[model samples]
Each structure stands twice: as C-alpha cells, then as structure tokens.
Target: MVSPFEAGMFSGPWRSLLSLREDVHVEETAEGDLVLHGRWGDVLLRQPDPVVRGVLNRMSLGPISLSNAVSGHGGGAHGAAAVLRVLDRIEPLVVRTVGRSDGRLLVSVAPIAPAARLRPEPLPADRPIRLSRFAMVRTDGSGYILESPLSLHRATLHHPGAVRMIGMLARATTTAEALGDPPDDRLLVDALVLLTAAGLVVRGEHAAAPAEKATFAEDTDPALAAWSPLDLMFHTRSTLGRHDHDFGATYPLGTGRSPEPVVRPAADGPVIALDRPAWEEILGVDPPLSVAVEGRRTARRYTGEPVSLRELGELLYRTARVRSLVLRQDGEEPSASSRPYPSGGSSYELEIYMTTTGGRDLPGGVYHYDPLGHRLEVVSTDPAIVAELLENARTAADASGTAAVLLTMTARFRRVSWKYRGPAYALMLKNLGALTQTLYLVATAMGLSASPLGAGDVDTSARALGVDWRVESSLGELLIGRPGTSSGDTGRLPVNDAAWAERAAAYLGVKRGG
Candidate 1:
C-alpha cells in the first residue's frame, strides 16, 4: 500500500481541515464578551485572546487547513497551536472535511453528538478494514451520505469514488487493494481514514481486540445480536441520545396545512349510532379503581353467552370515546382531545375497528368505531375476512375458545407525526399500550375478558376495512369475550405477580386441571 505521505499530492485529509458551520456565528455581548451561537447551541467565550477572533473569522469564511492556521493569524507555529486550541474549545460548531489529491472534495464529516470532535488522520494504508455492520449509505441530493446509528458523526460523500470505496469495505479490504493502480488511490484511502475516525468503519481484525472485532460480527455480539437492521434504525431514529434528526413538536411540515382531523370522519357505511351511558351513570356505577386495576388478566375461554351491543358501547365509551375536541387556530397544534386513556402530545392517533362473531344485537363483520359519535361504521360484512380476522386474533392471543369480538387498532400516522417528530411512531405505540390497558380494566369492570394480541395483519385489516394501509395502518389487536367457567384461571389471582408465581410453583401438579 502506498503511504498517504509518500510523495503524493497534498490534496487529501492527511491532516484536519476545519470550518465553522454556516449557521454558527460569533456574537458580541453588551459586556464586550464574545459568544458563539448556532446549531450547536450557545457557547460564551470568556476573555478569548485576539488571535482566537482572527482564527474564527477566517474559519467562518470557509474551511481552513489546521496546519496552516498560523497563516490566518500571522503568528507561526505557536499561533497555529493556539488556533487549534480554540477549535478544540468550539469543536461542536466545527465541520471537518477531506479532499482528493486533485483538491476535489471527497468526504466531509460533521459532528452530531454534542461533544464529538473529529481527529482527522488517514488510516494506515496497509491495514485491512471493513464497514461497520451498522453503517448505512444513502443518496442525498446530488451526493451521498454514509452514516451509522452507532457513530456520533455523519459523513457526506462528495465523490462517487468515496461511495464506491465504502461499498468495497463490505468485507475487510486494505487500502492497497482499494488503491489498486493509483489513478485516484489517495482519495479512497483518505476517505477510509475519515470514516474510520468517525466510528463508521471497522478496523481490521489485526488492529482490533477480540471485544472490538466482535462488534463487526453482529450475531456474535451479545449487545447487538437481537436487534434487526430495520428495528435498530427505527429505535435510533425515533429517539434522542443516539440520533441527530429533528425531534419533538418541531412541526417540520410548516403548520400551514392543518393536521389530520381529530376524529376520523365517518367512513361511508351503515353507521350504528351507539347509545352510550351518561358520564354521571358511569361514575355512579362503575367498579372502584382498585378493583379494576388489581383484577384484570387474560382469559381465553368464552361462554356461549352473548355480549349486548349496549355492553360493547359501554366498553368503547369507557375506554376510547373522544370526550371533546379542541381546535387551535394558531396552528401550533391541531384538534386534540380528551379520552379515558392517555396519549403523547394529546395526539389520540389510535382508531378502533372491531370484528365480531355476531353479538345478539350486532352481526359478525368488520366495523370501525367512530369515537366522536359513539358508533360503529360497518366496514365489511364479508364472512371470510371477518372469520379470518377473529381466528387470527384467537391464535395470536393463544386462546382456545372462539373470540367474541376482535378490536383492531389502526393509527392515522400523520395525526401524530405532523405535530411530533422523532418519537412519533414510538409515542403512538405508547398510546396503544395506554388504550389497551384502558380496555383491560374496562372489561374487568364489566365482567368480560379482554385479550391484547401481540401482533396484527395490516394487509388483511386494510382489505377488510376498505382503507389504504399506508394512510391508516393496524398497530395492535385485542380479543374481547365473555368469560366462561372452563376458561384459564387467569384473573382469579389478584395482581400480586410474585406471590402468584410462588403459589403456582408449589401447587402445580397437585391440582386436577392445573
């Protein structure tokens, strides 16, 4: 491998090239002190030497070679070292870049973590290396971006050769092999160095300890073994502490366009307006909070007893009916509402659609609950899809008996995502859990059983409900049934989880039907 320093052109990221981000600018306070402010937030520089100001001024105009920083301040090596110290102090505001020997840009890495500082140095030309398993590459505008969930920085590839070299690192390869015949050898090798420094590349086996090498072997690393590619991406993208994406109520899409309507307007179908009990009646007769909380559990067996439409209405009313809608014209937020269950940002994004096996008053069909009107919009009366939905619920919930009513939960994603960034989907999921818990407690209060399924079929749900899965998709399902004597002894034990486990362990084989 030809060394980066072996009489090659001085056009690579052999040493650090530094610049202040465009948004970052120096500000003067009334007290005559200097402050730096931009995407990196505010940093007050107390009594900074005058040379620091000159160094920053030069960096602000454009990228400056760190080795030649003294030329900008006119003070030689000592001044250059001082400028380097100032750069270190404001590292979060700096963007680091690398270029090819022709001086054409190769790659530029910018800090995403608050404390991240790039130590720009080319990798050993002879060392074999590979791309980190977590690293991903995608096109951005006219160029490409290579990043990883595990890395604190994101690198933008300005040249196709840089992108090509990253592809080559899919398996371990040395810079020599990559730099083959040297038309543009320095570019790829230097780009590899920058990516390696950004924690986006895996150093070769010989260069890494066993613990470090295991990180590249996803299946062998216990910390990463269970996380699938898409899921890990989702986890990092949806939360802070690992990502640089816009987060939380940023309202990325300007509020000019209103959010999705609070309650999904009535779907075209036969709507059965449910008769919900007054709030006074519920408060007057519902079970105590303690009883509902401690007594809830999963019950599979359903008696032949039919659940009345009024009872179903009561369950919906108690668990998910939209109590009221508040619209804000200021556009900071859209129409939000109060419900029995809680939601992040009050973005009640969960919609309830039910499939029942013919209750005494309601027939077996797919029906979406119109929460505002306290009614069911008959979605599909097709027997095949209806049975499939219920059967799928039974299997998913591990129930022996047929399900009485299967409630499929779908989310109008835009409702939450439009207002909240990053954790929008995650917040919707938390809403699902809260809503399901409300269902469980409400069912326990009504002497019925609620079984929350771990998964649901979006395709079948969309076909059954006659709605586009992309616009509105299923996130969860729950099987509601009338508990029978033969059902599993689930709720018979109070919510003392540990005590129940202990007693069951001691008496398991002794009971007749244990």
Candidate 2:
C-alpha cells in the first residue's frame, strides 16, 4: 500500500508515494495530544513522540516514500510499522501518489468515503476496459480531476501526459495496446490501476482482485435503467452516503460574513400591496390535516373564471410569506428565516414569481412576491413575455388555455449555495417539494384547483422575472384556478383493502400477517 518514489533516474519502475494532503497540518495540544487536521476532517492522536512528529512534518512538505520516510530516517522497522498504523487511522487525510519513471508525479488519489481503503492493483493484461459512464474528468484549479459518484476515492491528474493517458480509457483499450513507442511509459498502466481501484474505470467482465468489476456496456440493468445520467449525478452529489465534497454551512466560498442576506431584497419596482391573511383566522377556517392530506390531487383543468386577487393573496400568505428573520451569523451560526414551509438549515432561498394571466382583479404581467413585506413587486409588465411565461407553465402542467394564476418558483442559488456545497442544489429541490406540498394542502382546504408542475425553463423565467439566471433560477411551478365542473375524481382509496394488501405481499414474496 505504501511505495515511495525511489530517488533515482527514469529507468526504474514506477512507485506509489504516500504523504498527508498539502492542506493538512499538525497542531500539538496543551494535553500533549497531536491533532492532524486536513480538508476532510480532524483526527487526534492521544499522545505522540518526536519521531512521529518528524515524519508528519516531513510529509507536510512533500510526498515521501512511506518505506524511506519511516525505516530510512533514524527510525527502525518497528518505528516505521508504528507510523504506518497512525497513517491508517488518519487515512482519509492522506494522498496516494504515483510518479512516472521520470520521477514526475502524474496522478494522486485521495480517499473520499469514511471507510475508503485505496490500494492500486494491476489490471487484467488481456481484457479491454473503459472509463465508467458515470466517471467524469473536469478541469479543476489543479489541472484536471477524474471523479465519479461511484468512486470511493477521487483522483487528480497532475501532468498533461497523465490527461492524455486517461484519454486512452475513453474506449476499451488494453494495457499492451496502450504501450507507446518506447514501451517504457507505464503511466497508462499505473493510472488504470489507481483509477480502477477508485471505481472510475470498468472492464467487460468480472475479476477477483478488484472490489468491483464495473460491468461496462452491458445490457440494460434493471436497478439503474430508470435513472438518467444527470438525474443519477444529482441524486448522489446532493445527499450524503456517497461522494465527499465540503457540505453543510461550511461557507467554503466566503469573506467571513454570510454570503447571502438574511432576506432577499425586493426587485426595484412599485410594490403591489396584497392583503395579508391572519394566521389565527387561517388556523380556525382551514380544514383539518387529515382532510387536506387525503383530498390533495393534481387538478389540471381550471374553470374559465377569472381568479380573484383575494384568492392569490390568501394562498401566498398561507404558503410562503416570511414569518420572521433570525440573524444568528453574528454568533457563527448561519442566518436563517421562518416560513410556512421548512428548508434545510432554515435557508429559505426559494422565491415565488406570480404570473398574472387571465386574472380578474390583477393586471396581466409577471410579478415577484416580496415575502418579508407581503407585497408583489412587478418584474415585467410586457404583454408578450407575460403570456409566454404563463404559456410555459400551462404546458408544464398540461392544462388548457391559460392558467388563472401561474406560480413560478425560482431559487436564489447563492442563498443555499453559500451555506452548502455538495448538497446545495439538492436542498433547493427538496425545499421546492416542501413548499409545493404546503401549497397543495392549503389549496385543497381553500377549494382552489391546484396542479404542481415538475419542470420550468430557467432562462425563459429569468427573463420574465427580471433576474439573473445564475443568481436566481426557477426550480418548480404550480397552476391555480377556480374549480372546474367535475365529471369524476381520479381512482384512489384512503386505505388499502385486505385483497389488495394480499396481492402486494404476494408479488413481493412476503407473507401477509392478516
């Protein structure tokens, strides 16, 4: 697992160099404990001696051969073995490197998962292999990085030659085939071992030495068949138990202060004041939770009646108005706010944009909802663009004509992005669902026809809302109108009958209790 770049010429074999990540540093505590802190997290050794500290200090400076770093420098085999155990404990903070025979570092692999044990193994010399469909190589601040949601570790490509080395992996090419003119360049072979160990490369069939022989280009896999590439990527990156990126209020990109304001300021325009509904009155008049939950449905057809301004006011007041703004960043907590719907870390980053189309009391235009003040700020009054915004929502909901009132939900990206790294966009989607459900239950109780939309065009809505797409973009949409004449409700039941339960249990190959 530990091979140091031997201090020699390019004629020698390639080796794995081990060291603590450059970002890692050592801090000796007052209680004589040693703290090894890095970008991943901090680990503490109860107490350590001078030699261990010396090796750690040397590791901070540059990559060293684990063997040479321990046994070669004053410390004997026993001391080196002791240090190796220490590295194993803090393995997440360590980076494994492989240098070409020229003594130039080509690629470095770092553990991303908590239980990751990165050790490169030789590829099957006979078979062809390719990069996993999920694996991606993007230009990072440090040249290029190859990472996959499936990978337990992330690999950074250091040399330009290494980048070219991976290009050979795009298609299923073998080791002997990849060997270039001099037949001495082991860069491709060595990198494949590390990348394969990281689960970024896959071959046609299974092998015993590797943990996973990613079945590449196989027939449709039932487990992964339904997922699109983008959908799968988003699913993994947005939640924990997968890849490692800085997450949760770390404020990785900031200047000490909270990057976003406690409340999003209203766009510049004349504010159209709306009547704020009293919470006590809403509580008394609204239907019980059981009734609203059971009654909620996607009502797409809207009666051809002008949606009253009062209806819009009541809906927004109950669903999304800012109840309070809590400034906790002064004490090092993230600044948060209160709304009817819940958000991760209380980051209410989603904004509501109401499209005024086929309305009675309100003019036809797109307006931004100012939740803090319970007012609507006109964003675009143009008739054509307003119609386009409404049309898009109608299409997304698959409704006829125009929606009585179309609610477009846009997320102030930085508001959540500032507090979260890997899970920011995923949090935005979760917040969208929370608000959508709130609207559904409230709309059901109030007797308004509501249909929650699954999609919205970011650029189209951004232009209509007069906001920068990068700053704030649409995440969800909903259509509301007067209840249309009902022929029949969609087939549904509040409780499953005995027969249905038995059938479901049979299909799942489980015995039913009753």
Residue 302 in candidate 2, Cα distance off native in Å: 1.6
For model 1, give the 10-residue run with minimal summed lDDT: 1-10
The sequence of per-residue lDDT tens digits that candidate 1 reaches over residues 282-385 is 77656566666655668767664667899889999888988777778875544678988999888888899988878668887888898888899988898999
Q: What lDDT would each prediction earn against the true structure? A: 0.74, 0.73
Q: In candidate 1, which residue pairs clash?
A: none
Which regions of candidate 2 deviate over 4 angstroms? Answer: 1-12, 23-57, 74-91, 180-184, 206-221, 253-260, 266-268, 278-285, 325-337, 486-494, 497-514
lDDT for 138 in candidate 1 is: 83
Clashes of each: 0, 1
Question: Candidate 2: worst 10 consecutive residues by lDDT?
Answer: 505-514
**In model 2, what lDDT does residue 102 have?**
49
TM-score of each: 0.84, 0.81
**After superposing candidate 1, which stretches have Cα over 4 Å from the reference?**
1-16, 28-33, 46-51, 119-126, 181-184, 205-220, 278-285, 301-306, 327-334, 484-514
Compose the digit string of candidate 2's lDDT tens values, residues 328-391.
Answer: 6467543678999999878788889888764556888888889889988887779999778777
Q: Given candidate 1, what's the lDDT at residue 475?
A: 95
